[model samples]
Target: MREDIEFRTEDGVTLRGWHYAPDGATGPTPLVVMAHGFSAVKEHLLDDFAGFFCDGGLGVLVYDNRNLGASDGTPRGEIDPWQQVRDYRTAITWAQTQPWADPERIGIWGSSYSGAHVLVVAALDRRVKAVVSQVPLVSGLANARRLIRSDLFAATRQLFDADRAARYAGAAPQMMQVAWEKDPAEPAALPTQDTHDFFFGPIQDRAPNWRNEVTLRSVEMFVEYEPGAYIADIAPTPLLMVVACQDHLTVADLSLEYFEKARQPKELVALPCGHFEAYVGEAFAESAPRQLAWFRKYL
Candidate 1:
């Protein structure tokens, strides 16, 4: 079952989405707090993913990140990684107070960009009992370099410089397309064929609230983020890293390296697919059950 839900962050921004209750739950149930990757909204396969957990007797709190979807924040379509991390802590706090969620049995789930976020959140907040980071980004600077060409890197920095000047001069933040054509000569945030197909195809068809734009500063912050550094600290708390073997967006090897660094009580399952595939079709079928088992075991 799904109920419309919203909760306030410590900074006072209200995040809105749905709280799912397991069909046969008799009391407060283990709850998984979930959110999407990058600029994706809650409508983008989150419900489908949440369904897996709810059907398996787990409740879920799924919401959009700030400045996107139904959530409230200024400078719409902006993504500040640190701010998003803070919001995850706030979401966990909100979940603790809800009657449908077992305060002591809370797990956190995230995919793609949010997957990277869960790593950071779990390290910082002991409140998170279990964490499933699916096809997560480990090193932003390294991933960005992989996505962008060496020759174009300098130009990208210049663009960021220009946007910073514009913003400081009282102009709105410059925007960039999150993805471009299947074969794009023009630069886009996710300039890959798979990303284009997934975002503009299945993702766009499902989520109109999903935007194709984000502030230029978001990319800068993303590059500056290094969530993998916290992997060792996440030990003692059970950690699960679901890596897509073919994932180049976040890089499978990077995830594996970090997973190796994480302390005991951790597991890594590598799906034989790309980054986006881990969320749907056969890859999702394989990944979701594995994640549910992790949560059930730990949370």
Candidate 2:
């Protein structure tokens, strides 16, 4: 069972989410609020992940971040870490109102930035019972260094563009097409890969409805937002960190350090691929069952 819907946040911004319940659920069940990664819409990650969890007898709620897809917000892509955390917290509160959900048995699932956000939110809110951090961005400093190593001048240039847009137009202008050049030495900075296509690539070929173009400001925000800093704060609650071994976007070493600092009842599952590959390749198929099993056991 699936239903498209919207819920208002603490600041009056409406968040769009899809509620997917088990097919034959006759009683209340644990809720899984699946948060999408940075600059991504709910339909992208939740479409597949939600189906898996719902099939496993758990209800799922997946939503777009404010100012992104169907959600309401201004100055698109002005992603503040605090604001994103609040949005996820608000979604959890909204989920409690549903009659089919067990209010005290709520879980949060995230990947990339949202995966990191889950740790931050769990630290602040005591209501969350379980968490899944998939390909989590563990450190800002590490990512910043990685970006500079790959394209220092290109990263500086994008920052300049974002600053200019924010000052003159109240929001950074969207990039319909990334500044990617075919030549290697030409300094084109996107995807961080020569052949890595953007989110519009074939992963969504089976489902082409996902549309997202982020304001360049997200580049700056991501560099400053480090959820790894607060990893030790997430205690008692069961945590699962799914690491992408060859990930360039989020370093595996940094994530491992954070996982080590986390309290007991924590588990790390390292996949044999990069950041986006798990969402597209055989890794995702292998990883989904483990995540569902963990959430079912904890929440």
Provide C-alpha RMSD values for all models, in order: 1.2, 3.0
- Candidate 2 off by > 4 Å: 150-190, 204-212
Per-model TM-score versus the true fold: 0.97, 0.88
* TM-score for candidate 2: 0.88
* Candidate 2 weakest lDDT stretch, 10 residues: 175-184
Model 1 per-residue lDDT tens digits across residues 128-209: 8999999999999999999999998999999999999998999999998888864587668878888888887856777877
Best by lDDT: 1
Query: lDDT per prediction?
Result: 0.89, 0.78
Candidate 1 off by > 4 Å: 181-183
Alpha carbon deviation, residue 124, candidate 1 (Å) = 1.0
Tens-place lDDT per residue, model 2, 79-137, is: 56678999888888888998878999999999988899999988778899999999888
